[model samples]
Target: MQVIDAMHKITSHIRNPSKFSKASKLALQLIEAGSVKPGTVSHFFAILEAAMSSPGACNEPSVRADYQALFNAAQGVTECFNQQQKKQFDIWVLHAVVANDLFTDDSFVFSKAVGKIKDAISALPITTVDDDNDEAAALAAVESKSGTTHNNTDDNAQAAASNSLPDDSTHAAASNSREESSDPFGLDGLLEHKSNKSEKAREKTVAALNRKADEDESKRFLKSQREALLKCLEIAARRYRIPWTQTAIDIFAKHAYDNMNRFTMQQRDAITKLWNSIKEQQIRRKQGKSVSGKLDVNAFEYLQEKYSHEKISIRHAVGGGGERRATQWLG
Candidate 1:
């Protein structure tokens, strides 16, 4: 169910899949809204089943077929979560399915699969919804902050309505009377003017639209960055013949973000650099076991040849009392 577990099972079912190529294909499938169109939970499960059943370590044609199918399915699952605004849900569902041992459980449903997040959301402290009093209080607080007095608008209209008018401007009094009489809340009857309804509605509409656009843009940008990071991780996984879970990739992403100006650099560069450093550390650890008071270069080359497919050549020339021993490694 965890990302790593999914990755392992997936990797085991494919033979040398081109993860970078798959990433490119999946990236293009992203819609203009910036995510893959979501699939139903049933469809997602079906894809998972296909991927799990696919053959691994097959002939070239079979490998490509398996890769394409699995890649498509994986991409589908990723997009399913994303388009639905469920970031990281692909990995979450994988982990959940695994943890619940639901692969063989025919009775499990999608709602149950997704209920964990629902519980978390319900538990959040900010999720407070109550009766109409709370809504009224919220509205009142916002309205109070506008700084315009209720009397400023309708009160003036009322005053105008009551006043004596010269013959030339009789229409102005009539217009004020119509406006005051048209007040739906009857605040004007009390000689109090509320804000302009049409103007306030227009402002609210514009503000809401702007806020939604901003939210969408921010989500798109974040998704793009995360996709790029995931692409790098996938490439690394395939290249090194290693499996990665989401948690592991997340840790890598965290380190990469911390060190690379919060992922402003190309993600592949971080992946490559980190991979090399890790390999160097592993080599050093391995080399640590082979060290003794060593002087027999010929014997060392012999051992290297014996242990590896590649030949190691170490030449010793009788010069300066046969102390000159040169070593060269060839692949």
Candidate 2:
């Protein structure tokens, strides 16, 4: 995967660069605390900064795919948490890492811890954010209910007492009856409580609608990002000869497209295996096992057959071409 493009895709959802910076700082703190591996921290900073501050150097080119992918998911999830949640989340992560005995394999420990952190954060309820629309609607509703209820109650009481009796004693009795009938069983209190509940319900509905809109918009944004990244990868692979074959590039590119979020380290492992499969053959050939040091015929044929499709070259696929020509070398 193209590191820069992948970083952009992973972090594109972040509106404020400060949020990303804050997330990176939290990860850095985790690193310092020894909750996770130190190997990937520098890579994290490099790739993260490069993603955030575009045109910035990705100093650590040696960063592994697992680190890149995990950090991306972590950042996205962490950004969802509010300030208090984030602080709690950080503590939980540190604790989880220190107490983690489940993954004794060591090889998969970091990923497991990250997964645990994500699950924990996901379980926490999202804090409701109030907006002006919800507040205004609630205020308007409560005010309308109170105003109409008070005026109607007063008018009904006045009319009931006046229509009942003209004698002083009877008028006093009618007035007492009116008061009792108006809210005989504390219905006034009940009505006010119910009005409050209705206000709350309206607020909740508004919040839910806003949340849904945000989620839909985020999905659309990520979808567009994946499509654009896929197109760019395809264009790059078609015109120029990449170190890896078209099949490998296509496989990963399609994956990046399909799975825009939640990239797994396993995918990276698979790519490495493919790279090694081809690279090993090239090494063998250079050691006099074959004639060429550039391409391994056996490995190429095996992979091409395994991922069979009609190959299209850039020249025939499009009218024009990129200026850079392919130079044969191991990527």
Candidate 3:
């Protein structure tokens, strides 16, 4: 009943029908049986089924009918959801896309399929809930830090009452009450003195806003950096004939974050270094016939361990081979 699992099975069936026919059939049965509630799950089931039944390789001319079916199903799914839901659904679709290596087919049709899904996702308006929450939290934090009270109902009600005063007598009475409240010696007025406190509060509030702005800028920069790194990694993987997995991607993301400044400043050099290490690992892996052949996983784990221990070796790339206790060297 898991939509992603179904997607994986469907795409696997498309890739190797004979090997995965049972898995694909079971997945379709679970999805089509109505055991799961109808909305998003059903829509995804339709898309999966369409992909499963596709006639030819995604890049081939014979696959047009199958492509059309998938495209129509995706379109229908996109049309049924709001901006937020569509974005979520689009992410799920991307997971399916990556899980099946759909876009790695080196075909315009496969890439176009991905592009269509992205276009559908991009058509939706962006949600501001997180931004709004961040701002609200910043304001609240400043207020708390400044020991400022946010409750203004009484002050607002008082202003409203003054504005609603009907006659001169009522206005005079309100004025007297205001005068009494303004008296420095009065119990309420003692806390109402407009001194440097207001200026200090304003300064703190401004500082908080400035800090929030800086944080947002940092986030944007980090996002761009990560995207660049990921794009470069994907291209490098394709070039090296390596199959990347979600776990590998996650590891790369963490490594990129750890070395954000270096990666951002010299992306090519950084990626080249990382890729060289991976290539070395793959070369080492090929020597042993009994070795597990999950090259990407092994490479990723090697990088993860190397970086985590601050003992990475780039000398292997330059034919300088010596290892420290912390550095794991390939034989």
Pick the lDDT winner: 3
Give the lDDT of residue 316 in candidate 1.
11
Cα lDDT over the full model 3 = 0.38
Candidate 2 global lDDT = 0.35
Of 1 and 3, the candidate ahead on TM-score is 3
Which candidate leads the pack in TM-score?
3
Off by over 4 Å in 1: 1-197, 241-259, 264-331
The digit string of per-residue lDDT tens for model 2 on 186-260 reads 665665575467546545544554454344333323322222222223222332133324334334333433342
Can you give the TM-score per candidate against the true fold? 0.24, 0.26, 0.28
The residue-by-residue lDDT of candidate 1 on 236-269, one tens digit each, is 2222212223223334433443434333223324
Which prediction has more favorable lDDT, 2 or 3? 3
Task: Check candidate 3 and list the clashing pairs.
Answer: none
In model 3, the number of clashes is 0
lDDT values, one for every candidate? 0.33, 0.35, 0.38
TM-score of 1: 0.24
Candidate 2 TM-score versus the reference: 0.26
Write down the worst ten-residue block by lDDT for model 2.
322-331
Q: In what order do the candidates fall by lDDT, top score first? A: 3, 2, 1
